[model samples]
Each structure stands twice: as structure tokens, then as C-alpha cells.
Target: MQSAELQGILPGKLIHMLNLMRFNFNVRFISVLSLVN
Candidate 1:
């Protein structure tokens, strides 16, 4: 496959991974914030 094709797929996969990480982190943060409030 071409480099461009790999790059195109990479961002989607990276974004999904990032979103999952963000979701987990956000949930933890929200819970902590609620406790502190």
C-alpha cells in the first residue's frame, strides 16, 4: 500500500485510541471533581 493510504488509516485508528483514553480519563476526572465539590 502507499504511504498516503497508511497515513489515512493511521489517523482514524489513532483518533479512536485517543478517544478511548480520553473517555476513561474524563470519567475519572469527573468522579474526582464531584468528590471535591
Candidate 2:
């Protein structure tokens, strides 16, 4: 039962983490572009 719950939650958690990483990357990219300009 616990494992099943974890499995259900895992994809959401992974997507959340991926979103965070993408956001961080976008922020960094914008900062670099500003600095370059």
C-alpha cells in the first residue's frame, strides 16, 4: 500500500522538480543575456 502511494506520487514530484530546474535555467539564461547586452 505504501509503495503504491509512492508510485502514484513519484511522477508528480518528478515533474515538479523538472519544472523547477527549467525555471532556474531560464532565469540564468536571462541574466546572462542581460549581462551580454
Q: Residue by residue across 1-37, what tens digits does model 1's lDDT show?
A: 6999999999999999999999999999999999999
Candidate 1 regions exceeding 4 Å error are 1-5
Clashes of each: 0, 0
Error of 2 at 3 (Å): 2.3
lDDT of 2 at 21: 100
Best-fitting candidate, scored by lDDT: 2
Q: Where does candidate 2 stray beyond 4 Å?
A: none
**lDDT score at residue 30, model 2, on the 0-100 scale:** 100
lDDT by candidate, in order shown: 0.98, 0.99
Question: 3-26, model 2: which lDDT tens digit per residue?
Answer: 999999999999999999999999
Model 2 CA lDDT for position 9 = 100
Top TM-score prediction, candidate number: 2
Candidate 1 clashing pairs? none
